[model samples]
Every structure is written in structure tokens, then in C-alpha cells.
Target: MRFANQTATFGVAALLAAQPAMADVTPQQVWDDLDAYLQSFGYEVSATESMAGDTLTVSDLSLRLAIPDANGGLSMAMEQMTFTDTGDGSVRVDLPQSIPISVDVAPEDEESMQMVIDHGLEGFSMLVSGSPGDMTYDYEATRMTLALGSLTVDGEDIPRSAARATLSAGPVDGETQVTVTGEQRHIVQTASLGELAYDIFGRDPEVDGDSENSGMFKGSMSGFAIESDSTVPMGLDTSDMPALLEAGFSVSGRMSYDASESQFSGTEDGKATTGESSSEGGSFEFALSPDGVRYATSAQALNISMTTPEFPFPLSAEMDEMGLSFSAPLSKSDEPQDFSLGLTLAGFTTSDMIWNIFDPGQVLPRDPATIALDLTGKATPYIDFLDPEQVETLEGGDTKPGELNALTLENLQVKAVGAEITGSGAFTFDNSDLETFDGMPAPSGAIDLTVAGANGLIDRLVEMGFIPEEQAMGTRMMMSMFGVPGSEPDTMTSKIEVRENGQVFANGQRIK
Candidate 1:
């Protein structure tokens, strides 16, 4: 009997999750124990579910109160609901197509009230069909409604009133449909729209079994919009808080993996902000290999015409492309083992920029010119399972013996504000001194850069107030004697070697 009750009551959630039914479960048992479960929750059953062939139908039931959804308490009075339990081990429920809640708060209580829900679930049907692992319930519906009034948790009036929300989700293996909705009807408050969430999913069959124990996953979103300007954060306490993807959003993407390698790829497009400047466009891709992971990103034709409190003015431009790629060896312990890095930029030029994107503090000068860079480096590990002097035994993987050294080449280039140069150098040491700082060694590397054009650039800087008149004259003197940044000061040249020990020279002429 206890087993029958447990299996019967769990049918709803089981149907939702589509739990397998090939074990010990049956339809007669569902009907025999379902009403008892409903009655246990204090629901006065007005009628028993009728039967049509293999389906059990329960209509004209009043949900006086449900297990207090999330926010606690039930508000609607005569909302009709229906449930159908198919004799073939399946169940379904039809809820109000649209449910809008109205809050009647006095002006005095308005400040105490945070938000109100207006329009909500109109109707939905759930299906508990299929085996245990595949059992699922589906729901669907049109638009929902909502309304709200301004209130404050700490003390403030809201700006807008009333909101409406509705949700819907897929064809689950040709088994179930799910839909949810919310809105504000007559409530005159700023926070009207109530609990809202939406989501969608597609099978990733390609993730068949290429990689080891891990599988690859990828996805994309055309867009998603979240609007809860007046809702109070405190009103969320229930466990079944809809879903992230279930909200108003769109996307598509893919990914896959094998024991040693994996990859993910996708793009996103949608309104980031509101007003005359709201626009969006961005994409990202990533891949993993024995060497580590690599990724690229870009934001095209995005609207920079945003005017925030910091800018105080309209800012605009296009981030043609900017990206970075790096990979690191799996960790040997609590500490990281090996590492590598690389970065790049193309058509990445900003215009009328009030603040610098790289440095939000506005410490560096903004550039109106093009930019580019190429860099790569790596770091070795310390622990050697090959050598057993480390410890008695290891846990996850292996343990480091005494200490480790990072053999690295911190090479890089830049076309940054006030400078354009390239250099190659290393700062990480391999296995040098191991007694000073625990077991980790030092870092060492060198860099060589070239400023292809120096005269025209210096001239431009001098005119732009970056360089003073006296400094410009002194610069000319230095140029004639030595060479410019990349070449001889007088004749335009091509590269400069900057030693790691702090030495600067161009065209064989030592500048520092």
C-alpha cells in the first residue's frame, strides 16, 4: 500500500521528468491512488475523472489552493482545471489559458508592496507518456496579461505599472508540451508583470561518442529580452523558478567532445539596452586540443551610440573584431601545470570614444587608428609522477616533487595609444634556483619591436598636444643622431630590439 501511494503521488513529477515506467507502475494503481494524493493536499475533489477508451478525464475541479506555488498563497477564485490520465501509463492537466492577478493596495500600503502579477497562465496540458527516462508533459498557450502598482521594500515609488507575460515550450519526443504565462490586468502599479521564464532545446545527436567520458555541446541565441524593472528581488523563494532559456530568447549552437579533445561554437544577437542606441551583434567560437583551448570573438556593426552617466554624451563605433586564444595543460595538483597564449585584432577601430574600452578608468589615451597584434607563449609544469620523491601516493592525478619551474616565452606586440611596435621575449625560468620561493623558479624572456613609421607619427602627436614643442625639437635631435623607433632617427627604418635586461636600441643604435 505504501509503495502504491508513493508511486501514485510521484506520477505528476515523474510525468514532468518523464521517468521510466518499465519497472513497477500501472494505470489502475494511478487512478486508485491519484485522488487520494490530491485529497491529501486538501483539494476538494468535485468530480472523479471520467474515462474515454484508455484515457481518464477529471474536469470541473476548483483549485482552492495549490501548494502555494512560489511566492506563497493562491489568489484566483473559480479558475477551472482538467486532468486526463491515459490508461497507457500517461497523465495530462489543462490549466487556465490566461491568469491575471490584481493587487488592491491602499496608498499607504503601496510603499510596503513591492510588485504585483497581472496576466498569467491561460491554459496548458501536460502528458505523462513514454518509459521512465523519456516520460514528459507538454504545455502550450497564446499571450498572457499582468498589471502592477508602485511600492518600495526600502522606500521608493515605482515608475511603471502593470506587466504581462506568457511562455511555451516544445514537442518533447512527440510526447509532451509545456507553456506558462503571467500578466497584469487591472492593477495600477509599476511592478505588474509577475514570475516569468521561457526555454527551448534540441537533441545534440552528434555528441554520439567521440571523446572519452566527456561529451561536446554547442548552442546559439538570436536574442532574448529580460524586463523586470519594478519587480522586487525578495519575492523569489519557490524551487520551481521557471528556466533561463524558457524566457523570451532565441538561439542555436553546437558542440562535441572526445576523451582528449572538445569544441564549442555559437553566436548571439539582440537588444542589449533600450532607447535610440539599443542594438546588438556578436559571435564567439572555441575549440580544445592536446595543445589546449583556442577561441575567437567579434562584435560587428554594434551601436556605440549609448549615453550613460559616465559618458554623458552619445558614443558610437564598430568593434570590427577582437579576440584572444590561449591553452593550459591540465593541473597536476591544486596548482596549474602548463600554459600557452595568443591574441589578435582586425578592423577594430573606435570613433568618438569618450572612454577607453581596455581601461575603463580613462587612464590611457584613446586611439582613432587601426590596431593589430600577434603573440604566443607557454609554461611548463613542476610535478613529475615519473619521479616518486613527491609523496607516498597521489589522489586525483600526480603530485609535484620538490618545486617546479615555468619555461616560458612572454612574447607580444602592440598598436596601442601613442605607440605601434612588436617584440618577442621570455620571462619565465625553467629549472633555475629552486630554494628561494618554495619550489617555483623565476621567469625570464626577451622582446624585440619595430616602429615602422616614426616621423609622421611623432609629428602628428606633437600637433595633437601629446608631445610638447621643446620635446618635439629634442626628439628631432635624437632622431638625427640615432634612428627613429624602427630605423635611424633621420632615415625611416624597420625594427627595434628591446632586450629583456632593459636595453632599447633601433637599427643597431642603442637608445637606452
Candidate 2:
């Protein structure tokens, strides 16, 4: 139920944001442009318009759009909206204080559900200005909110107390500039908010005079900001995302926040549990185009704690920094396209309670653990993954979708307890002779790695009974066979190589 409402809210918001405000816009022109924009996306738009001297009043405005791949669609209504010509070549937009949005979702083989959401605003203002090919809009608000109004399932209304959800943001300001060229609309937007928050609570209806499950979630973020740039084809159907992309739709955006915190509590089967998490700061970036897609996110100083009836002690963990990033091509290409992936988790540590369970005598160093990786590669894609028809063909297993041509391990590091490892490598694959590698692409490359404190860590593990003495001996013998001793104590270095002829070597010794 909550999931359904959230999906509707996000869908409506995205569609609204995607609508382009045309240039040389009068009050009537602006309204006409909005109507055209919605109609282009297959939405049924209806409204009553009245004019008085330099002002236009739009009443009973309603919009309906079919939900793709679903049995039902979405409907939205607003009581009133007003546009006034300020006589200075600009227009003012007055929106209703409250807007109601309704969605009907009928999943295949499931009962239909209806959800109503109320969007509210306080002290909001919007102004539109500029000429025939370019336009600008400035807007601000003291507070804005969205809350679940009602829910109906199988023609029966659910009690209000059974579910509740609300999201709010305060003191927001934003600006958008739209420029139209031959057949494309270029849009740039920037926005900032002082704070944003959400709360959701749900409880199963009483059965036999007793409730079996309930949960609540609350969270907040401060100093939120975002910037986005997009190029959209005119008269494009947004409902068909693959078609839209093929029509030259592209977007890039970045968002950042100063601080965030969240808490959750739930009860199930007579057991109660709670959890909380906080982060000092975080940022996210994304890009999408006909050629490829990219996403990256990073956070700093994260802390988490949890408590449950099944655990006697509270569990906690902390990290100084965390990050993840990935990029890959989406369109087909005869030549190799660039791709990269990376992950980092630095300065990670957990509570002593967790460590004590495994290391009662503290035989190993209690240092912060870190893991990092950076990889770049090249691959030729035979078919566009974003195209549904090509995806179906690929899924049918009639032909390979792509081939990996090259890969470079630019960086790698892992450190924990009393041991550490670091390495870097690059490889190129041959697709002609898959049989030599057992139906896998053959690779030719070399990786150089260094290890420190491995023997000491193994000894500590043996003392803790985590590793049998015989197994430890075998491990040491294997290490000696593959690596040469480094200058430092308990340190070893090795170079692993794979030849084009399928031969493998470690430290210049032929291993296969």
C-alpha cells in the first residue's frame, strides 16, 4: 500500500517537472503551452478558463494519463489556478493551497487498489519571464508537503489509523531556464532547500481483536541542493522511456546534502526491534544518454546502531568514508566503449562487543578496516540494451549481446585486523579461441601485488582455532611457492601473468 502511493507520487512529480514552459508566453500562451505539453505525453487534459482584464482564471483543471504496462492509470485534479499578466512582460502563477492526486493501480493477477494523495503548499510564489526562443521561471515557497489522504482496496476503504505517510520540505527556492531550438528543448534547473523530512507508519488491521504487525519510519536531511541539465525532444512520449531515449532525450544531475539521520522501529510476532543511522554529508551524481549511463555516490562519517529482542547487546558500526560509482554503455557499438567501476569503504570499525565474541584475548590488532577497488574496461555491445526488442532477442539466447575486449585494474586495496594487500593489473581478451579457456574469453595480462603481515595474521587465526595448524602449514607452503620475500619482515611480493597461449605463471615460475 505504501509502496503503491510512493510510486504514484514520484511518477506525477517527474511528469510535472518534465513539462517545458515555452517562450514568448502570455497568460493564455503559457496555459496553452502547458496543455500541449501534457497532450504530447498522451495525457487527457481538461480545464475551464475565464478572463478578466489582465488575469486568467483556470478552474476545475484535471489530467489523466494511462500507466504503461499496467491495467489502470493515474488521475489528478485541482480546484483552481490563476495566471496574471504583470504588464512588465512577465506573468505570475497562483496555485491552489491544496492539490489532490489519485491513482488506480491494477497489477496483473492481483486486486486493484486506489490511492489518494494531497499536495500542500504554504506561501508559494512563481514568476515567468523572457522571449520567443528562451524563457526563465523563478519560484519559492515557505513550506511544501505531500501526505496520503486515503486508500481503497477491492472497493473497501481502509481505516486511516492503519496507514499514514507524509513528506515535507521548507524554505525552498529554485530557478529554471528553458531554451528551444529547432526540435529540442534545453532545460537547466537549480534548487535548494533548508530541510526535508518524512514520516511513515503502518499497522496491520486487528484480526481477532489483536494486531500482529506494525512499523514506523522517520528521517530528515538538511541543506539539500540540486542542479540538473536536460535535453528533450519536442513532442516525445515520456511514457515510452526507450522511445524517448531514442528520440535524443538526455539528462545529467547532481545533488548534495549537509547532514541526514533516520530511525525505524517495528514489532512482529511479539518481537520488538529498533534501528537508527546518521551521516555527516553525502552527494550523488547521475547521467543518462543514448550512448550510456553513469551513477556515483559518496558519504562521510556514517554511524549506525541497532537493537533487537533476539540480541542481548546493541550492535553498532562506524565509518569515516564510503563511496560507489559505475558507468557503462547502453547503445550498440562495433568499436569498444569505455566503462568503469569503483568502490571504497575507508576507516570502518565496529563495537568491541562484536570483536570480543571472536577475539576474546585480543590476539590481533583492532585496527580500522578498509577496502577499495577501481576498475576500467572496454567492451563492444552488439545490441542496444535499452531497446525492448533487442533485449528480447538477447534473452532468447540466440546470439551473444556483447564481447569484453579489455580491462584494467587501476587500483585495489584491502586491509583488516593485522594484514593488508594491494595490487594493480591490466588485461586484454581474445574472443577467437574460447575453447582454450573452456568456453571463456582468453586473457593476456600481468598483475603485481604486495602483501604484509599475512604470516602473523595466520598465526593469530590458528591460535584462535579459526584455522587448523595443518591447514596453516599448507597455506604457508602455497604462499612460498607463488611469492618471493619482500624487503620488510613478513612481507611478500608477486607478479602473476597469463599468456596469450593460455600459459600462467607466478613470480616467473610456470604454474600452468
Tell me the whole-model lDDT of each prediction, alpha carbons only. Answer: 0.37, 0.82
Candidate 1 local lDDT, 172-258, one digit each (tens): 111222221232101001111122223212222223233212211222223321111111111222121221112211111212111
lDDT of 1 at 265: 19
- Model 2 weakest lDDT span, ten residues long: 11-20
* lDDT of model 1 at position 404: 36
Every model: Cα RMSD to truth: 17.6, 3.5
Q: Please state the error at residue 281 of candidate 1 in Å.
A: 2.8
Report the C-alpha displacement of residue 102, candidate 1, in angstroms. Answer: 15
| Candidate 1 structure lDDT | 0.37
